[model samples]
Target chain A: MPIDRDDARRVAHLARIRVDEEDLPALASEFNAILGFIEQLREVDVRDVEPMTSVTPMRLKRREDRIAGGGIAEKVLANAPDAREGYFVVPKVVE
Target chain B: MDGLNSLSISEARDRLRVGEITSMELTQACLAAVEEAAALNAVVHPTPDLAHEQAKAADARLAAGQAPAMCGIPVGIKDLFCTEGVPSQAASGILAGFKPAYESTVTSRLFEAGAVMTGKLNMDEFAMGSSTETSVYGNTVNPWKSGDTELTPGGSSGGSAAAVAADLCLGATGTDTGGSIRQPAAFTGITGVKPTYGRVSRWGIIAFASSLDQAGPMTKSVRDAAIMLEAMSGHDPKDSTSADIPVPNFEGILTGEVRGKTVGIPKEYRMEGMPEAIDELWASGRSMLEDAGATLVDISLPHTKVALPAYYVVAPAEASSNLARYDGVRYGHRATLAQGDDITAMYERTRAEGFGDEVKRRVMIGTYVLSAGFYDAYYNHARKVRALIKKDFEDVFAEGVDAILTPATPSAAFPLGQKFDDPVQMYLNDVFTVTVNLAGLPGISVPAGLDPDGLPLGLQLIGKPWEEGELLDFALAIEDRAGFVAKPKRWW
Candidate 1:
């Protein structure tokens, strides 16, 4: 579970955040600190406690399963740096 | 003066109804103010032509005898929201060039109500910092202090708060995940409200912990808060989480009488190393309620200690999942690699270069908490603690307490980089405000008074999920009695 410079480098690659080699040490250190914090939770007694997904303690409201969405597609896509064919245009992934 | 920049939403509506101040004039005044405050660095992108074009249409509607409550009001949309045609980045490199073809429902609703968006205000990238310092664009400085270089307006909705506080815009939209809206409002000494989650649709607002993300209005007055909330709240078919309750007259219900309300003064909020002025200001705020015929009741939110840690766990965990879409292929800045580069390498290179250290720190924390070996230990347990925190509020509310009051932040806005060194300490700035978010309740931060350093101290009010009416009434009553008038000198 320990994250070294290599692991941090991999994470940086995954997250699309550009971190230089010099910065990888700091990122690794930060990752270790976070892992250390997570380790502290190991001491808590939570065997019987139920995981809470929401605070309201209410059942999820049920709606009839149906496709109903409203909003202009042009208005939605207006912020995209590149858009074509009514979808976000990205570099060709498949040759 | 164009009514849009200076007039309250109600006044603006009245003018629109009677044809007094034209929407175009109002929109122009806001554009002019944005130009004047360019040095404030409040607005990241100004869409003056778009705003004016919208304003012209609104004016035509009014001239044709159409009456919209928000007709002609120029507002600032925090850059976190995606505005079609305008760039929508979460103020981070990963989302740098990513634009949503869709408008966030909240801002679009505001536009539908005739509020012209003047520009996109700056925010901490992905709403991830207390000081707005995490913004890739740049850190936002407070408008309250005149000529002080390092004074922060607060974050990650710092620019939204600054624009409203500096009178650059009539009202600005803010999204609160963990104290983003109210903390910035407090720092700027403005009136900002974070409605109960789902009260406003999050359909178009960029996600920041889906459960906690909410779009609210930051205005200069409580009345404006009401009018704006009415315009902002509604059931959006796009946002499945959007509430279906009918929006209330937030303005009309301001009877300003807190006669029978039992306000809770939680003891746990008073911690060690707390300042004397904060106690004095809190006491003064309480006394104001007592004078207004409300009883000050002592309450115990016993699990208050766990709110911050739980929030740190839950928010970041969700953030890790929510932010995963920003790989190089779909949207945002793509770090360069050779042709036929593996997809995984592209993601790694792009994310590593795209996010800043604080953001990286958060993503790391988020990933760690949700990772295979730690999910049950970290995220699951924190969620249980979250339940306890919610129970504390429920028990107190069941005991006849209408609202709870606490200092919005542990301290007034600290030096620019004061808490940056210690990330945990920086996260603790959200301690007082996070519980409300955890409880899925409504809370607001009103400027209470000044600390010893003359920085603004804000008092937070926690209310029942749907009882903002009672809460705002109580806040206004206290605001009246406290006579806390510390306006920003930069404005004058």
Candidate 2:
């Protein structure tokens, strides 16, 4: 199915990317092209085929649910765009 | 003696051990070559002082009678691999000015093996594009050219391939999520191998698609690839997916003997509209292996045609989720927020301003597929198709096919800006390569021959999972018989 401009805007919003109103047409067209190509997968008979997530047959290695590492707040926050008082400073979430 | 920059890792290792050359001399030669080839736009960040210091340390180790295989060798670390305090962007503006306090596991392992880091090399932004055009540092030109018609070094590991082909470094680290390593190696006429999915640790390398991403080596020759891969691979407790199996001595196991090996040529790969030169190169590659005492057989992978579609769906889906961590809050680039803007607005603006066109396109596709209404049709179906694709390879291997051979790329390096307009056309560059990634198998692209246009053409060899040693042995046979020693002349 060809994605429309509204669909492109919704996807951009869902992905947390702000798409300008003017660019939605171009974005919609690009999405349509890619999805049109991807539509070919529907033709394959995937009856009873288990979806493969990990290529190898190994379970996720689990460990004790205990905190083993941390406490270097400065190093952790080194790359943050805005960090103050050992925490990331983001725009106010509360009204 | 020829310049140290031009020597292979194995050759340089031998030279360093025999005291014929010091690591400092080799490092200087490479540094000079990097300076001379500045027009290539290959090395994004040159770490000359770190390289010199590492070289001195390597020399001291050699003096004390301790020499690892990679001792004193200067290699380029792709920009994706984080080096402590070095700006490790995946060639994306979103990662602008983000320097990691910790080094990636692969680079640290290479350093442990006494390798010197020459610099951070360029790559496709977030390892996304097939050509280096997506790189924020600018496109890395292919060292091989067709008479002044500048070409792309295929990415997302384009800089690693270009540097190795141009001899700026002995070998460079490369990551192959889809065709990043193999395609660029083919375009630049070098050797690159993407080892089994968990063979190399993905601990510190920025995640694109966690399931498909793998790190490997881009080098001048097959032997160099083997040596470097041995150093770059090992199980890390830090990476849960890293295999618990012991690392093999890949270089030592190179018997160059594919005798009695049954090499399969998948009938499906003979796609319609394939270039005549690619067909010729594939036939000649088969004969070379046959002459080296391996038997060739015809096989079928019926799902081959659908692998690309499945990959586009799965890769983008995964990328969307992985990239969600890059909001304005934690790290990397953030957009200026006007007063009264909320957190959600900040996130949207930061991501919108930070990501490039291609990345945004992928993120959009990803979110569309995974959205509430369409997840089952696109994302779930693509995962099942991926299973079928993997089973196709497994059935062939179970039938005693030692490896599968095919053209590394549909064609050699095309002129830059040729395929940028159409995304599907650019995606087709990974047609011959995406299956290996989908199946999580080891695949190597060996420089097999030159096309009639005097550009390099490569032959890909896909091996059983975690069997890179055997794959490299087959590649060595092809490399030896093909006798492809042509190098691009110094035009840059």
Candidate 3:
């Protein structure tokens, strides 16, 4: 399917990226070109073929469901843009 | 350039063993070379202090009669692999100034084996682009320049290729999602191997497409690749997907004997409108293998044409999911928000200001494909197609085909601005190498010959899953016969 400007805007929003209104056409065109290339997959016969979830055949490795690590809250908060009292500070979410 | 800096890992290791050279001297030579070649922009974050400390420790280890194969060798760590307190930006503005508290498993293993880190190397932002032009540090110049025209060292492992080819470092770490290591290695006249899926631990490497991403070595020769890959491979418990298989002594098994080995040349790789030089290179590569006593056969892999399309869908889909962690709150770059901006606006603005054009385009594509209305059509269908591509390789391997040989890239290194504007045309550079990534097979790019312009061209050898040692043996056979010793004259 061809992605229109509106679709590009919506995709940018979905990806949490802000796309300027004027650049939407260029973004949409790029998306269309990529999609047009991949659209050739429509001809690939995939009947009875399972979607490859993992490249290697291995089960999800499970460990004990407990707190195995952590306690270094300082290190965790080291690279945060804004932090106070061992918590990341973000813009106000709740009024 | 006539110093220890030009020595390969095997040569340097032998010298270190006999006490003919110290790791400190070798590292200093490389550091001096790196300083002189700043025009290449290959080393993004030069850790001279760390390199000296590591070299001192390595020299002590060498003197104490404790030596690993990689002991006292200076290698470049790709920016994608997080080294403790060092910039591990993945060459993306989104990760600007970000440094992890821990080292990546591969780097840690290399360090444990006494491999000294020269610095963090440049790469495409998020390992997304074919050329290193998408890098935050700008594109790494290919050492092999065709006349005065500057060429790209194909990426996202471009810096690793450049550093190895230019003798700035003996060997460098590289990551391959879709031909990142192999393509750059091919363009720069070096050796690169993308090991079988789960063969090398991916822990602490910045995720691009988790299922498709792999770490490998970019070096001067296949022997160096084997030695470095042995140090880089292991089962890391931290990485759940890391295989529990035993690590083999890859360098010890180099017989260079391909006698009676059945090598297949897939007919699908002979694409329409292929450059004549690449075709001639492929033919000459077959002769080299034949002369080395390997039997060649023509094979069919019908799904080859669709592999590129399937890769675009799956890789972008995974990239979108993997990159979601780069919010404005936790780490890396955060946009300067105006007053009254909400949390959602913070996320949108930070991502917009941080990511490059190519990264945003990929993220947009990924979001569209995985969106609710199109998930089944684009994402799931591509996964199913990926299954078919993997099966194509499996069938060929089952038919007694030990390995497959093909051109590493369609053409030699192009000028910097040649294919950057067209994404589709740029993606085609990986046509011959992507299938190996899709099928989770080990693939190596060995420098085979030079194009008419005197630029290097490499031939790729694809091997069975977890059979990297065997693959290296075959590559050694080609390396012995091809004798590709031409190096780009120093211009930097």
What is the per-residue lDDT of model 3 for residues B19-84, given as tens digits with 9 covering 90 to 100? Answer: 999999999999999999999999999999999999999999999986998999999999999999
Q: What is the lDDT of residue A8 in candidate 2?
A: 85
- Against the true structure, candidate 1 reaches a TM-score of 0.92
DockQ per model, Cα:
0.38, 0.89, 0.91
List residue ranges in candidate 3 displaced over 4 A: none
Give me the displacement of residue A64 in model 3, in angstroms.
Answer: 3.6
Sliding window of 10 residues with minimal summed lDDT for model 3 chain B = B360-369
Q: Would you estimate the TM-scores of all the predictions? A: 0.92, 0.99, 0.99
Give the interface-residue alpha carbon RMSD of model 2. 0.8
Top-down lDDT ranking: 2, 3, 1
Model 1 has a DockQ score of 0.38
Model 3 DockQ, alpha carbons vs. true complex: 0.91
TM-score, B chain alone, candidates in order:
0.96, 0.99, 0.99
Query: Model 1, stretches more than 4 Å misplaced?
Result: A1-22, A32-47, A57-95, B1-4, B15-18, B64-66, B146-149
B143 Cα displacement, candidate 2 (Å)? 1.1
